[model samples]
Target chain A: MAITVRIPTPLRTLTGGADEVHAEGATVGAIIEQLEANHPGIKERICDDKGNVRRFVNVFLNDEDIRFLDGLQSPVKDGDTLSVVPAIAGG
Target chain B: MSGETPPWVKGALRIEAAVLRQVEADALACYPSEACGFLFGPADDPPLLDEMRREDNEADKYHRLDPETFPRTSKMYFKINELRAVRALEEGAASGRPLKVIYHSHCDAGAYFSQEDAATFASGGTLMWPCAFLVVSVIDGEVRDRKLHVHVPGTNGFRESPLTVIE
Candidate 1:
């Protein structure tokens, strides 16, 4: 279950400059957990201090916004691509 | 009854002062989240700000307008009032005047367009020309910034002009 997760610019620090990373997981949450396990601080950036996803961050399972779908529980199969895009504030 | 003309309309076709004021006022009403609305068109010179709606929920803050409020569907996108958009289009077509623009707000943000905005523009479904995109950001419920963008098919796609509020 090798999955590729695309990281946004703000989260690049934890990934050591890797914009995208490969992880193995049966679900999106599992993949995120795997990412946190490897990078340590990446989870904090995606989720709020209280653990819910930040209102500004949108995680897409492929091109579809996860909120309209199953949200964080949205499943991911082998070779799936997950993209995390933060709400950009700059004009 | 009087307001500054829309910053983009200049010498060619000036948007009425009243309409411009409404755009600013509506933008402020939807603070902490982006506001959106329908620009009624084709009757006068520079379109009219006929109807306005504000989404206060901070569901998705990806662009100037909240994404959850303006969802991506097949034909048109988001929570826009279809009847209003249709009526504007119908009248514009009948009068041979283009609807001219599809406007929205961007709270507490600058005026430059973003990639999400570009993707929405490139969806290629609605009026493409004279059809401009507007952004208004309310900082602490004060309209600190406003911007207008028109598509340039030949260039990178949209040309932006910042708007100044006149007191």
Candidate 2:
């Protein structure tokens, strides 16, 4: 399934400065893998060494965070927009 | 309760006196807990900030869910929900009033950007956002002072930006 992914500013370099890009996948994890294939050095920024989403990298499917769903195992369909945003937090 | 205003800091961040007051009010309301929000306005040499979009400090929820991941509580930190943030960014772009400033209050601390703050905005020496950061100092349920921080060039650090409050 082709999905549109919204890219944040910091990761724009990998996407040729495009704010959004399209990829093919049936799950969030597969989509991320597709993103890495399309844009090298992106998965490392979004996921940790354990292949888990980075705590500082916030990923959402539409208005809902994917973490709240099934995480990497989350199912996906057409017209789903995945947004990868930088976590806004500090002490 | 610190920070000196200088004509330095890229350019002044202009805000209506009333809107700024509302930000202080939110900071006061959160008091012991740090308050967080976004300042929406047109980007200009003197960015005119007119709206304040307050956010719920989601630190506590995250901290409770996984202390190993999110260790800081609301008392010491502020976390803006990313889903809401994506929506805000999208809406701001459509409305022509982009989020120019991400503001947060420091409970009983000075209005200086802490190390963690620097780490958040500039992880791996890469700046996350193109906007600025405003840190407010709230001590004893009262606002003492505030400061603006922008990414320092060629480094993973931020420098103070001038904040001009107008009436």
For model 2, how does the per-residue alpha-carbon lDDT over B60-112 read when each residue is reduced to its tens digit? 98898778878899999899997787678668766666777889999999999
Which candidate has the top score in DockQ?
Answer: 2
What DockQ does candidate 1 score? 0.03
Model 2 per-residue lDDT at B49 = 84
In candidate 2 chain B, where is summed lDDT lowest over 10 consecutive residues? Answer: B1-10
lDDT score for residue B48 of model 1: 42
Q: Which candidate is the best by TM-score?
A: 2
Cα lDDT tens digits, model 1, A1-91, are 7889987545666888887899988777788889999999888767877765664456777766676567677788887888776532212
Worst 10 residues of 1 chain A by lDDT: A82-91
Interface RMSD of 2: 7.7
- Residue lDDT tens for model 1, B1-167: 00122322321223455676787787666555455654544445453443333323322432334455335321112233323443454576577554545556665566556666664443232212234677665665677766676655444356675433333
Candidate 2 segments whose C-alpha is farther than 4 A from its true place: B1-11, B43-46
Predicted candidate 2: what Cα RMSD to the true structure?
A: 4.8
